[model samples]
Target: MAVRGAGRVRSEVLSKKLYCASSTPPPHARHFADNQCQSMESFFTRFKNVLVLVAILLAQTIGLAVQVRRPVESGAPDSSKVTLIRYWAVSVVSPFERFFHGIGYTFRHGWSNYVDLRHTRQENHDLQDQIARLRLEQASFAEDAMQGHRLQAMLDFQQHYVSTTVAAQVIGTSGNDLSRVIYIDKGSKDGLKTDQAVITPDGIVGKIRDVFPHTSQVLLINDQTSGAGVLLATTRIRAILRGSTTGQILINNLTPDNRIKPGEQVLSSGGDQVYPRGLAVGTIESIKIDPDHQPYTLIQLRPAANLNQLEEVLVITGTQTTLSAQAQKDLAAGVTTAEAQAAAKQIADQQAAEAAARSAAQIVADRLPSIHEGEDEAKPGTAAPPATTPPVSVVPKPLPTIHSDRYSPGATPSASDLKPGAAEPPNEKDLN
Candidate 1:
């Protein structure tokens, strides 16, 4: 009974305390509750964004795992197994990748093309320059070849003539066709003198008129005051070649009976002593009767040399004495006076023998009787004439003996001396 009574009492006291606490009690407890609620709201506001990101990542991871774990059905296409996530990702990124790739490829292609074009243009320009240089070189080589040919011709001419000559370059001209004069670089200092013959390899050009220290004036063949003695090649007709006021070469003192024809070559006759004999002057261009001078023919000539375009020339300084001097020296050294005298005597004896033999052969041929064809062929039925012996007075002449001191065993008879019914001429064999 006592324990029960105590318990009840204690219970009543506790119940009274609980009721008071529930009713709202201390100031410290109420302030603590408000602070806890404010702290919880501030924490939620700061962590909301982080929580949302974490939720999205978790969702992706779960979806990938589900796809990986999904079972494939038999006989299904491989496309069915591809997840929409992968398809969406490829579709969304492919356009941007392609756009950037196209831009890069276009830039690379354009840059390469531009570089190639630039290089090609530079190469083309270089090739053109090289071609131009080659053309210039070709022209230079051609000119050199022509000059060499001209020099070769001049050299040949010099060697053939064996005359002393001085080479000169045409420096100036009269500048008018009427004067027909030219100046050469050579002058008196170079052994040029007045009346010296001037010529080119092709033909005679002119003669030196005035000589200066460093230059000489040449009177061309076509000058009015110029004259040369010329002869026609075929007819050997001699005439005076003179120049007219109009720079034409004219042959004067030729009558119509001279038979001058176009295209006939004319040559120097050496009558004037200025030009060498047989030097080419010109070819006959035309022939016409002179109107001013009756009975005389006017003959025009085309010059052998290119007189209007003279470039180089040769001046004859002296006559052809080199060959003659060489011959004289050789003769003096190789033959004695006695040997020459002996040779001359032998030559005279041989000539006498030849002349005697010719006279005897002529006499024998004239004395021999010749029968006519008509007499030998008498009437067919008639008898032929009987042969008769010549009289003793018509005896054949004896051939003259050739007395050659130095007879050669290989001597042969001359074809010109052999005649019908004539005795053979004496040869060196017969003399020996």
Candidate 2:
């Protein structure tokens, strides 16, 4: 009976405990527990990303604080104590930066090479053009230098004829036979004027017909309308040298009585005032008489200037006299033109008479009798003189003697004191 009671009580106790444990909780407590679980899960779900960020920030803050504390104690960090943060940042970001930087550098370097090549090609082309231009300039400079030398020589030679002159280049020509003219690279701006006489070192070339600021047209002497006052050099006869329609130069206005021959030289007469006197005009080529003109002779001439191949020429701006101013002053003292001419004629006549006397003397000397061989054998210094009388008795008229200026007053001769058929007085050679 005791054991049964004990077992029953235990059973009852167990029932009670089981009943109590298994019984449903109060509504408020169950509600509270359910509410708390939901609240905790929602909180964790909603703030999980924020919680991770907070943790990372807290870790970085701690590391920064530690790094900052070390710098404060050491005043400043040395290379050995360099912060790990800097190295870590660089390690993480440097690869990306290096890759991007390498790409940028490659692009820039290639673009630079491309631009440099383009510039080099352009520069080479420009340099080639400049070289060509410089070569042409060098050629022109050489030509100008040569022309200057020739012009300088001409200036020196023509100092008396040319007072002053401007150098010019023959640039062009009138291309037609009707108008024989050339264009010079000089003009009014350079002091060139119309009708200015153009010449060369050889002879007169032409006259300026038109003038411009930078150029002038020169009418050549060979033109049909051109004429120059000329004189026959040998005969001293005045004539007009005109270019014919056929481009032939002829000396007209010469009377039939005027003696003109081929090869006679012609000279400028200065009558036209275009050319100074004594400039060579031409040489006569041929002569013919015009029956219709009754008295004028037609004389052809070869112009002195090489008109076909003219290069450099001179424009005679003015004339310079060969005679000095002092010479003219002295010449005007006692000498009249007529008296001077008369004196020249007397001197010419005296010279002619002396020439004739010399001729007679030579003839007499040639005809003299030869001495015997015995005379040739005589001693060189002791030979006997030859006979004065020759086979021919040639009479040589006495020549008028010119006295020096100091002896002129006392050396004058008179015809009344002259003897006829007089011979030279004997000298020591005649008596030998």
Best by lDDT: 1
- Cα TM-score per model: 0.39, 0.38
**Model 1, span 1-432: residue lDDT tens:** 999999998996676456445647368776675555446545766798998899999998986675553464211112333524433543454445446645765786898777547578788899999976765555445445445546867776432233688998776676677678787777778888888889998999999876665667788989887889998999999999988898888986888865667999999988887888789999999999889887888999999998888878999998862245654454343344435555788999999998788677656654654334344446667875563433324434333336542233225555676688987666554566
- Clash count list over all predictions: 0, 1
Q: Tell me which residue pairs clash in candidate 1.
A: none
> Which regions in candidate 1 have their CA more than 4 angstroms from the true location?
1-162, 321-432
Q: What is candidate 2's lDDT per residue for 1-432, written digit by digit as tens? A: 999999998996676455444545687686665556557656866899999999999998986675565324211222323434434543454455446645766786898776657678788899999976765555445445445546867777442445666767666676678878776767778898777788887778878876655667788877886888888899898988777667778876887654667999998888887877778888989888866575778888888889887767889787774434553343443244335555788999999998788777767755553434344446668755585553344433233336333234334345566578875444433466
